[model samples]
Target: MAAEQRKLLEQLMGADQLIGTGAQGRNAQLSITDNKVCRSYLVGTCPHDLFTNTKQDLGPCSKVHSEGLKTEYETASSAEKAKWGFDFDYMRDMQKYIDDCDRRIDTAQRRLEKTPDEIRQTNNLLKQIADLNSTINTGLLEVSVLGETGSVAMAMNEMHKVRTAKHQKETAERDLKNLQDTSGPSGHQKLQVCDVCGAYLSRLDNDRRLADHFFGKMHMGYSDMRKTWKKLSVELKGRAPPVRHHEEEDPYSAGPRSGRNQRYGGSGGGSGGYRRRGRW
Candidate 1:
């Protein structure tokens, strides 16, 4: 494990990396992979910045999202970017993430089909719990009354009923807990998968939480990935001519001038000066 940790990824030389070889400010002069910088952000967008506090939250990024390093990466020439191939590397990594999220979205859709509205299931569970509790209470009362009447066997039998009801109640409680976990943290809402990241969001959530979902990092990160893919997939991979660039060409330029005029001379009645030329 220590040996694995010692391995470093290929890294671009940063301004701060000048302090190499047992230097103070150079990440303890350790392996290149030991840098505190976040490679994902350095190459492009970092997934860590997205889906914060949501179900798909990836937790905080382990490395720093240094703006200076990001700027340097962006300003580098196309040749340099091609040499590094960070764009395509990030693309593959993000392709896996997107593919996984797509699967989750599909699964969530099937789950939604089965569940429809989970709140209704929750209500049913609650009703079952209430019925079970009522049975337990009634059994306990019967047990106590039978004991008072000196019916020892009947009281023991009634106690058995109470025990069975209690066991059923426990099972129902665990089921309810699992349902709530899937439904929402608040425990009363219907769940829907986010189209962007496939994390479950509450259908009954308020504006505040909804806004958070829209603006949150994980959702936004996937959104960024899509936008980047639209461009980089063609640019980095060298596919068809970029339609975006093609669409930006000036639309109103003068077309080619060719042979169109006749060779006839001017009219005799003050109607003409020079004869029309095909090249004019």
Candidate 2:
């Protein structure tokens, strides 16, 4: 790169010349050949002859007074023409270089715009929470019964109450864990103010429930945000989220929530990392 810069600088100097050579001979041709000069009057070098009269058809002509004056004149003319051609080529190259740079800058700016921001991440989390809330609410009703006054109905009602309480606790815990995960040691943690309910819940479970009560439609809109962010960062930046936890341990780590963790109605290690959602 440094050497290329130097070469370009050299071209800028007057030492570099653009010369014209014949297509047939590849040799510099002079307008004032021996035949032409012999026919002309012998005279001391004059500016008019040196600069203009000596050449025809834009030929290389020399003005230098020296023993090799004739040869020098031809060589200098060719060099000058070559330099002009080189300059024209250089200007064209410079324009192309600038155009390429502009394209690169535009591409970079688009990528930056698509990059995830704190507000987007937060909105995404809230949507996930709303989904979870809906699931819990539906599950509660599915397992519950309403009936006229009766012994069996009362027993069923008691069971339904127990089930509902259990469900709420489990969902709340999942929401809490999600909140901690996003807000913990991970520097990328981000959450946005809740637009629907005007109240915020960092936990997934809580956020979902709140969204359900406030802005149900808008909440799920961001369900794909996490996946989207992961995809964009991987494809564009060539980086991934930090692997902060080991797969075998750390009950708090994200994966498929399942097994003993589910039975206990708590967040803990399982076959897969994510805990299975259940009524606590």
Candidate 3:
């Protein structure tokens, strides 16, 4: 029964452990396999490692590496480390932008289906306006040919109808233009994806949110983390293990040497040494 319950719990949770091995270890491993080095280390800024006596909070790398790789990383030159650090965040952001574009395209396609109906409505309005115009022209001609003051009143009524139809037609055309601009191939509101975080960027002239978004902490942090992982991975794979430098020293001078004066000191003054006068 206990086994069954455990199995059920595992199924519900989808995994045996909620959290895997810590971020630092995972990232360290990934740094080796991915051939991307950690960015923090490249700039002489990485504070966490096996040798470091501090808390580890950094997350795992998307790639893979192992513990033995750390020594190779430490031996690499600063210039080499820098070369490994690439803009990984930018790639992630670009992927996000691509996703946004797909969604926008989907939405635009749905709205595009309604465009035909809008165009049809506009055409109907134009036809109505044309008919009204014809009626007004015909009425004016009748009044002019007859020279009848009573017919002038009839022409004025037709003129009023023409004006109303023209106004309605104009309104329809305006609506049609708006719809096309929003969902058409040549839309005024073009979309741009963020290079840092994959968020949809507005192309509106008045939108100033892009400036603020680029400076957001989330974007910068993700970028930095990605860069670190890339650098770590590359450095681990490309560089050889760090060579341990052993300094050569004279065995006699390994520790403090006995001074000539101390070795010669004695109880009284002599050719061999000086000695204390009180001691026999």
Candidate 4:
């Protein structure tokens, strides 16, 4: 976390480019080609942040996230930003990402809705609970009546029946409670999407699993994006002319950029040692 902060600070201040390295003893100019300046960060969130240490963990963004570049992009004249194309590319990428997540969420929600088979199962389970309770009550009533009549053997036999029924009732109640998961007011374990990450989750999930999801990188990354995208989109629309879809090429890369960022994730860089490749 600290390393990320330091890297961000350096990029923001242009310190890495200014202090130890410069062309002809002058500070290097900031441009789209500088991978150190994340184009996505200029307008909104970067994709690399969406997952970390998760099944879908995305490693450190291939491009750097720098407040300095964002500020530069922000303060530039409308024409300047238009020429840079950073804002447009970011929005384009982000919209597609957001749309895809929305689709997934919709699909998950539909899947989570109770089907006829599941509903019938739940109803059957409820009936079992009710029948077990009724048996337990009836046995208890009989035991009480026999005990009052001084029939000790009969009362004892009735008490045993009640105990067995009581045990069955307890198990049935537990299952019922589990089925009535708190994911929704509905009486079933309806899956819910984690608002922070758009991933499907269930209230029936263990506390530890839920904690891991909330604290995990992908979820937090989406949190960061959620906070930024809508505001950024509004700001861009008001401030600059809209970009068309014809230009699919990323203006930042002179040619195709390597998918270096995808190589590093929870596996610690694919055992090929991204660090050994001197990427870090």
Judging by lDDT against the true structure, name the best candidate: 4
lDDT by residue for model 1 over 1-280, one digit each (tens)? 5422222211244334433432565553332122355556767766655555566767555555455567777898976655544554355445556667777777765665535467788888899999999999999999989999999999999899899999999998998888876654334357666766666777677989888877877777777776665555555433221111232221111221111001011211111111221110
Ordered list by lDDT, greatest first: 4, 1, 3, 2
Better of 2 and 3 by TM-score: 3
Which tens-of-lDDT digit does each residue in 56-130 have in candidate 4?
655566565555667777788977766665654565455555556666655665665767766776798899988
lDDT, model 4, position 3:
60
Judged by TM-score relative to the true structure, which candidate is superior, 1 or 4?
4
Clashing residue pairs, candidate 1?
50-217, 50-218, 51-217, 51-218
Off by over 4 Å in 4: 1-75, 79-89, 102-122, 146-164, 170-193, 198-217, 236-280
- For each candidate, how many residue pairs have backbone atoms clashing (under 3 Å)? 4, 19, 28, 3
Question: What is the Cα-based TM-score of model 1?
Answer: 0.42
On lDDT, the stronger of 2 and 4 is 4
How much lDDT does each candidate structure score?
0.58, 0.33, 0.41, 0.59
Worst 10 residues of 4 by lDDT: 271-280
lDDT of 3: 0.41
| RMSD per model, one decimal | 21.7, 29.4, 25.8, 12.5
TM-score winner: 4
Q: How close is candidate 3 to the true structure, as a TM-score?
A: 0.34
How displaced is residue 48 in candidate 1, in Å?
2.5
Better of 1 and 3 by TM-score: 1
